[model samples]
Target: MAPPAGYVNVRRDVTDQFYRYRMPILLTKIEGKGNGIKTVIPNMADVSRALNRPSSYPTKFFGCELGAQATFNDDTERYIVNGAHEANRLRDLLDSFIDKFVLCASCKNPETELIITKDEFIIRDCKACGQRSNVDMRHKLTTFIVKNPPKSKKAGKGRKAVAGADSIAGQPGGGKVEGEDDESDDELTKKIEAGAAQVMSEEQAQALIAQREKEDDWSIDTSKEAVAARVQSLDSKLQNSLVLEDDDEEGGGPYETFGEWVKEQREGEGVTDADIYKKAEEMGIAKKHKSLVVLVQAIFTEKIVEEIAGHVPLFGKMTTSEKHQKSLLGGIERFVGEIHPDLIPSIPKILMAFYQADILEEEVLTQWGTHVSKKYVAKDVSKKVRKASEPFIKWLAEADSDEESDDE
Candidate 1:
């Protein structure tokens, strides 16, 4: 079918008039005069819907390329750039955005879904060629995409419909039988007969029981001593599993040495948190903010939220100001978002744990969650970690509101 008038192929470079994927033509209106001049894309919502992207993305892309401020009003469905831009020129720029972010690199098809991975990478999953292509992370718009992820459509009903089709395909005639919907009673009778035919006879059931008895001869020794021995052996294996190079004699700095030493002590046996503090003191970095960051990344594991209470005294002794608290949060961002991303879902609980222990202040937590940064991890990873921490941040805001109400 032809794409009706006023629509163009999504890939504008392809001159195929019969292209199935099409979007509305770009439209721009110059508003205001001189210094207050702006270009309003009145049809941005329709165009973005056709391309399966948020309207703010391409609008922000224009802002980045033209060095202009772009504003999008979701309620009004209006996208405006802080300069006069011709519709033809904006259309050319839209083509560039489609090529980079919409079209599949492998098949050049517009049927692609944007996927964000746990490690903070943007991928374009193509439905045409079944290829996953990486998006250029250096682009400024990718940061915005990460912060505002696309809403995914539910597939449960579609999957059930497909399953019903597959069952029909498996039938003898490869189609639904006549009057199938009206034969519910007959269908129940047939199912009962089939179930009866599959039942085991007395002799077969006895044989099966005998086979099960013959295969159940093994037993495990779960005595206290045996369990303790197994645990000790497992601990020993875990300790020797990771090999850290001795960078101390190779001109590594005090923070590096302290981090490595903390990792070593965590892996080895019989090293208390007090011993770690004493070692840090001996190295003259016990109160350093960088050392606290290193200690956070090195000592904690996947069970950080549960185990953090035990080390509160050590952290309390080191963290004196907001700078130290910010450093600690940076360490956690690297630890959970970069090193062990399986802990990403636990980020809110982890932040709440820190807040309850007085390790992270509410002001700092609110500030950190407000924006995404690439200081500790990749920008995408920072966004994911912050997104996961939204629940705790919201709770903090509600608590503050309640306090204000009580003061009134």
Candidate 2:
């Protein structure tokens, strides 16, 4: 009876229904290439929330009913099946899942909680009617529901405990000695030890020294400390295949100087968000789009959500190109990673802010989500950021689908 975007009353056949409770329509996206091709159900989480069940239940049911492999990528919240399927067909199939697992047998109400006893019995505990009904345990989803049980209130409190531990674990100083704060010192010591080991192979080491001596003509420092430093630098250069350069004398490296510039601008007046980029361009910082990402991280403080929302116009202007969109994603990854890794939970809100601002389009985000990269953050941080962004990414896909439907 209402617009179908946010919440819609399910199915047309329920003529007697007067309830205001509603559920989102099923939205699916086809993604990947060749053998990697799959149908991604983006709104499974919201639908499952409406049905009072784990998101995986209906996803697995779709796979079983469709006779295809369903994989729940928990990281991306992209519940994908191994084949392409139509949205209407999947939506109809979801009604079946609701009938079976969601609705209580006695009261026929969706206000039900799944209960599993030590005897491995699957029971639906209805809060509305106080009726307990045993669900048929024959379905494959029962085993999954048992293993991946619903998170109880007690578990919700325990999440705080986990968060506390993660805060300590996420820091670079997580595994450091109590009093040792200098990471550079530890790094230098390790490099020296590694260089000493490289000097062990008599023939190879002699050959390298001979070559260096011939090239330097003994004009360079030949002392033991100097030789060891030279060996370490050579090994570092060979490993990276590049030399590390200092910040530009003009304005300094983008990251090294941008934070101060941002602080100065934030304290000043009449500087619109786009003007920041223009200023960056004047300093040659915007020449590299990746530098924009670094500048983004430098610009924000702990209140990243508020900062991003306030600066939406700036992001919208910069994110016109695919490269800039990808860089914005990378910048978000870095900002959350170093500033407040605990803010990983706020990824969905951040993404929604960008989406509402028209900074990140669904197509660009979907393309970026299909791959995993550590170009901007560490592998672990990358994984956490990706996992945190799952819900928002899924919502974007559904929103895009709804727009397409309205267009058609």
Candidate 3:
């Protein structure tokens, strides 16, 4: 999506201390079948213990400072009860900490999902290949590992690069440079092997670096990476310029032909499909099958249709990506949101992002009417314009009445 004006957007920010706002969660204690104790400690009994496990792999234990630095904690193992001596302490600590982040818990699956809410905690969904469980460990807002590295209590004394390493590149032994010259068969074979490994990796490393740079370029300006939402911006702009000059186009009793006058009013307002289509073409919304304006107009009243059409860009011609379709639907639903709540469901044929955020909530609909009523029919801060016309609208009605009276 396009970044709003006046902000230096970054992929993420880590300049500030990561916050892990705690939430209330429910936990089922499996401490023998008969005994269960529930006490809110000073709340959680041992968050520090949960904070000690390195949030990543071959499972190293560290100081809480290092473990708490992750942008997100997968917290996948709700209970790793291996029956080892260390299992119960970790189990207890995890149970206590998870109670603070509990989204939900499932007895059948034994998964406790927690929702961690903090700027540091970016939300993610469950990808466990089953239905979303009672414990939504996925969407928790969590502070992931930042600048800190996990400190091992098991570390040996000197921190020499190879001397300190237990496994160099995961093979038990460190690699040998081997013989410098190729006079002996054994020396030649070792030299050949080392050379082959280096030669094989050289071109591959270069290719991987080039690929990563391209990805980084896209990350720097995420707007360029906005697959569907960017396409909708053009439609949103066009929808803004359109306005209704006359709502009484069906005409009054034969006093004067308001239909002809209405046509002149629309022309004067410069509301043409061609003008909309020009922007639509640029937006890449394929409109060959139907006039874009007609599709937008069908969802709202004619008065709203004319006004919104001039500004909002039409969904251009057809394209290959499904994201474009999603963008078109999302943009249209946003416009429908402005006109009325009842029209939102009609905007999207397949799926509506507006629905994802509760667009039809009565409070949202009321707020929307209050927000846009000022722009269209009237600027009534009191919201009397929801039913009664604005002063300008009332004057237009009165003017139409006076013209009829004079003709009679």
* Candidate lDDT values, in order: 0.66, 0.58, 0.27
Ranking by TM-score: 1, 2, 3
Q: Tens digit of lDDT per residue, candidate 3, span 267-286?
A: 45533333333333443334
Clashes of 1: 0
lDDT of 1 at 335: 80
Comparing 1 and 3 by lDDT, which wins? 1
Best by TM-score: 1
- lDDT order of candidates, best first? 1, 2, 3
lDDT tens string, model 1, 87-198?
Answer: 9989989999998888888899866667554323466656568665667665656655654566532221110001011111111342221221335434423532333121
Model 3 residue 79 CA deviation in Å: 29
Comparing candidate 2 with candidate 3, which one achieves the higher lDDT? Answer: 2
Instruction: State which candidate, 1 or 2, has the greater TM-score.
Output: 1
